[model samples]
Target chain A: MQFLLAFVIGGIICAIGQLFIDLTRSSVTPAHVLVGYVTAGAILSALGLYQPLVNIAGAGATIPLSGFGHSLAQGAIKAVQTRGLLGAFAGGAEATAAGIVAAVVFGYAAAVLFNPRS
Target chain B: MTQSQGQGNLQQQKMQQELQQEYKQLVKNVKPRPPVLKNTILAFLVGGAICLIGQLILWFLKKEGLGDKEAAAATAAIMIFLGALLTGLGIYDVIGKYGGAGSMVPITGFANSIVAPAMEFKREGFVFGVGARLFTVAGPVLVYGFLVSTVVGLIYYLIR
Candidate 1:
C-alpha cells in the first residue's frame, strides 16, 4: 500500500515532466522543468503546503527535486529563528551543505574515472 | 466559361489533397514514433525504485534515533552521493538511457546532472573546465531554487 502510494506519486511527477517534453515539442529542456519544480516547491514549502504531502508520501514526495526546495525553506526557517535576518542569506546553503558538498566531491571522483564524451 | 471555372476548381481541390498527403508523409519521415508504453513503464518502475531506496534510508535513520528532520536531510545527502557515484562510474547514463524520466526526476538525477557536466569539462582543465562547467545543468536549478527560497523567506519573515 505504501509502496503503491510512493510509486503513484513519483510516477506522476515524472509523467508531468514527460508531458512538458511532449507539449513543447521537445524545445523546453528537462533542466528548465526541474528548476521550475524547485522554485514551486520552495514557494509551496514556505506557504506550509508541502509538508503535509511529505508526511503522507514520505520519499515519494521528498525524493523529487521539489523536496530539495522544501529543505531549503525549512533550513531558512530554522536559521531565521536562531540567527535573525542573516539566515536569509546563509540558511539555504547551510541546510543543503551536505548534498552540495557530496555532489562536488563525488562528481570530482567520477570525472577522474570516466572519459567525458563516452 | 462556367465549364472552365468548374475544371479549375476541380484541379485546385486535387492539388490541395495531394499537398496534404505530402505534408503527412514529410512529418511521418521526420518524427520518429516514440515507444510511449515502454518509456512510461520504465520511468514508473525506476522512479519508484529510487524513492523506495530513499524510504528505506529514512526508516533506518529514524530507527537510529535521529530526529525526523535530521534523518530526512541525511537521506537526501546519501542519495545524492549514490547518484553522483553512479554517474561517475558510467552506470547512471545507461540507466538514464533506459529509464528516461524515471531516472531523471529523482534528487539523484540532480546529482547526475552535476557530475555529468564536470566529467565532460574535465579535459578542458580543472578550474576553467571542470569547475566552471560543473553547474551547467545544476546551476539553473540552484539559482532559481535558492532565489525563490530566499524571496519566500523574506516574505514569511516580514508577514509573520
Candidate 2:
C-alpha cells in the first residue's frame, strides 16, 4: 500500500510535467519547473502542510524537487528551534549538505572520466 | 512616371511574399518531429522506477534499524550516487532523451544536471571549467532554496 502510494503520487507529479511538455509551445523549461516545485515544497512545508503528505506518500513526496524544498524548510525550522537565529543561515545548508556534496564530488569525478558530446 | 513607380513597388511586394512562402516551405521540410507519445510513456515509467528504487532503499534502511528520517537521507544519497555514476558512463543521457521529465523529476535528475555541465566544460580546465560550471543547473536551486528556508525559519521563529 505504501509502495502504491509512492508510485501513484510520484507518477502524478511527473505526469503533470509531462502534460506541460506535451501540450505547451515549449515556453517553460524543465529547470523552471524544478525550481517551481522546490519553492512550492518549501512554502508548503513552512506552513506545516507538507509533512502529512510526506508521511503518507513516503518517497513519492520526498523524491521530487519539492521534497528537496521540504528538507530545507524542515532543517531550518528544526535548527531555529534549537539554535536560535543563527540556525537559519546554517541549518538549510547543513541539512542539504549530503545531497549537495554528493552532487559536486560525483560530478567532478564524472567530469574527469567522461568526455562531453557536442 | 508616378504610375509606373507604383506598379514596380506592387511587383516587388508580390516577389517578397513569394519568397516568404518558399522559406516557410523549406523550413517545414527540414524540421524534425519528436516522438511525443513514446517520450511521455518513457518518462512515466522511468520516473516511477527511480522513485520505486528510492522507496525500496528506504525500506531496507528501516529494516537495518535506521529511523525514518535517517533512512530518507541514506536513500537520497544512494540515489544521487547512482544518478552520478550512470551519468558518468553516458547512460543517463539516453535515459534522459527518452524519459524526459521522468528521469528529471526525481533527485537523480538533479545529480545528472550537475554532472552533465561539468563534463561538458571540463575542456576549459578544472577550476574555470568543471568547478565553475558544476552548479550551472543547481546553483539557482540552492540559492533560492536556502534563501526561502531562512525566511521561513525567521517567520516561524517570530510567530512561535
What is the C-alpha lDDT profile of model 1 across A1-118, one tens digit per residue?
6656766787776666655554456567768867977887888898899989888878888998888898888778777778778887678888888877777777777776777546
Model 1: colliding residue pairs: none
Residues B1-160, candidate 1: write the lDDT tens digits.
6999999999999999999999989998998777776777777788878888888888899999999878988898889889988887788989888777778878999888888888888878989788877788788988987897677767667766
Off by over 4 Å in 1: A1-3, B1-30
lDDT of 2 by residue, A1-118 (tens): 8888888777776766776677676676667767777888899999899999889889988988889999999999999999999988788888888877877887788888888664
My TM-score estimates for the predictions, one after another, are: 0.83, 0.83
Each prediction's DockQ? 0.53, 0.57
Clashing pairs in 2: none
- lDDT at residue B58 of model 2 (Cα atoms): 89
